[model samples]
Target: MEEMLNNMREEDIKEARLMLDAAVAFRGAMSSAMRREIMKRFCELAGLPFDEPPTIVRRNPFEDENLRNNLQKFISEWCEVDEIATCTCHELYDSFSDWCMCNGLTPPTKNVVGGALRQMKMFVSYKSDATRKWRGVRIKEGEER
Candidate 1:
C-alpha cells in the first residue's frame, strides 16, 4: 500500500484524498447499511475481497422534464430581454406563482426559480433604491406585475 501510494501521481493522489475526505464528511448522513454497502463496492472495485450488489443512485427530481418545460414556457410567454428592463425578485416570484396557478402547475420555490434563472444566464443586480432585481429581463406588456 505504501509503495502504491508513493508511485501515484500527485494529482491522482489529491483527487483520491478529496473524495475520501468528502465521504468522511458525509458519513454522518449515511445509514450504517448504506455505508457498509458503499465500502463493499469500493473494496470490490479496488480488487479487494467484498460481496455486495451494486447500488443505483436515484435521479434528481429538480431536473424533471415537466418542470423544465414549464419554466421555459413561462420565460418565453411572460418575460422579455431588454438592456434597460429590470424586475424585482418579489415581483418575479409573484408573477411566476400566478403563471403556475393559471396553468394548473405548482410553483417552484423562490430559491429554485432564482437558481434556474441564474443557470439561464440571467444576472442579478441591485437598484439605486437597494431593491434586488434581475438585469436584462422584465415582465412583458399585458402581464401581471
Candidate 2:
C-alpha cells in the first residue's frame, strides 16, 4: 500500500480532485426538471451518452470554475431553493463526508448534528485533517517549520 501510494502521480491527484468536484454531493431538493437540466449539462460536458462506459469520465478539470457557476445556476433554476430555508444543515456535512471518502481518508469524521453546526463541523474536520496531512509531509521534508 505504501509503495502504491508512493507511485501515485500528479495526474492521479488532479484526476481525483476533478472527479470529486464533478460529483454532486448535495443537490438541494432537485425536481425531475432540474435533474434533466443537470443531466443535459453533464452530457454536454462529457460529450457522449449518459450511458457511456465509466459513468463519470468526461470531467474537465480546467472547467471547474465554469462548471461550478453553471451548477449553481442550474440548482437555482430548477429548484426554488432557499439559501437559508431550503439549504439543509447536513448538506455541507454530506459534502465533507463525500470528499473524505472520495479522497481515501480514514476514519471519516461523522457529522451528527442535523443543522448548520453539522456542516461547520464537517468542514472543520476535513480542513483539520488536510492541515495535519500537509504538516506531516512538510515535517518529513525536514526543510520547513
Candidate 3:
C-alpha cells in the first residue's frame, strides 16, 4: 500500500537523521562537505533529491504553509521558547503528531514534519541542555554555535 510505503520511508528518513546526528554529536559538528556527502548517500538510497548540507529539506516537504504555521503556533503554545529554541527533528515530529491527534486530524509522517520544520527554520539536531537528548536543534541564522 502507498500509505505503508510512506510510513516505511518515514522510518528510513528518521533512522538516517538519527545516524547523522550521532556522527555530529560524537565529532562536535561536521564539516559542510562531510554533511553533504552523508546527505547525498541517504538521499540517493531514499530516492529523494540531494541538496546541500544543512539544507537537506529536499523534495516535497509539506508544501502547505498554512499547515506549517499552524504547527509552529501549536508548538509554541505547549513548549517554552527556550525549550523549542533549539529543538530536534524527533521532538518536532512528536509535537506535530501530538498536535494532529489533539485536533482530530490525520498526522503527517515524521519525514513530512522534519521537512516542514526545516522550511520553517526550526529544525535542529544537537545535544540538548534540558533533556540532554539529541533531537532537532533550532539555531537562529548567523547565530549557530
Candidate 4:
C-alpha cells in the first residue's frame, strides 16, 4: 500500500485525503448500523478482511416501564384519537412538558418525546402549510397548554 501511494501523483494523493476526510465527517452523522455497513463496503472494495464488530444494544430512553406507564396515562387524559384531530409537534411537546411538571416528573426533551410518540404508533404528517403535526390525534378540548 505504501509503494502504491508513493507512485501516485501529489494531486491524486490530495484528492484521496480530501475524500477520506469527507467520509469521516459523514460517518459522524450516521447511525452505528449505517457506519458498520459503510465500513464493510469499504473493506470489500479495498480487498481487505472485515471483522464484524460486536453489536452494541442501546436502551431506548422511553423504555422504562414506569415512564412508559406515565406517558400512556398522560396521553389518555390529555389527548384524543379522533380522526380529524391534529396537533403540531411543538404544541404537543409543550403540553407534554407541562404535564410532566404538573405530575412531578422531569420532562424529557422534545426530541425524546417525539420518539416516544412515534413508538406509540402515532402517525406524523405535515400540514398543507408545511407545519409538522401528528395525524388523528390532538390534545383534549380543555387541555391546551
Top model number, lDDT:
4
Candidate 1: C-alpha lDDT: 0.72
Q: Rank the models by TM-score, top first.
A: 4, 1, 3, 2
lDDT tens digits by residue: candidate 4, 1-145: 5554466667665654555565689877868777676666555544468999887899888665666677788887888877788889888778778889999999988777777777767566666577778887788777352
Residue 68's C-alpha lDDT in candidate 1?
Answer: 67
TM-score of each: 0.51, 0.19, 0.40, 0.54
Q: Once all C-alphas are superposed, what RMSD does model 4 give against the true structure?
A: 7.1
Best by TM-score: 4
lDDT of each: 0.72, 0.37, 0.60, 0.73
lDDT of candidate 2 over 1-145, digit per residue (tens): 3343345566654554454344555445556455555555544444435643344467433344533343334333332332222333244335444434554643123322222332323222223422311111101111320
- Each candidate's clash count: 0, 0, 8, 0
lDDT of 3 at 140: 36
Q: What shift in Å separates residue 138 of candidate 1 from its native position after superposition? A: 0.9
List of clashing residue pairs for candidate 1: none
Compute the lDDT for candidate 4: 0.73
- Stretches off by above 4 angstroms in model 4 are 1-58, 143-145
Clashes of 2: 0
What is the Cα-based TM-score of model 4?
Answer: 0.54
Better of 1 and 3 by lDDT: 1
The residue-level lDDT of candidate 4 at 6 comes to 63
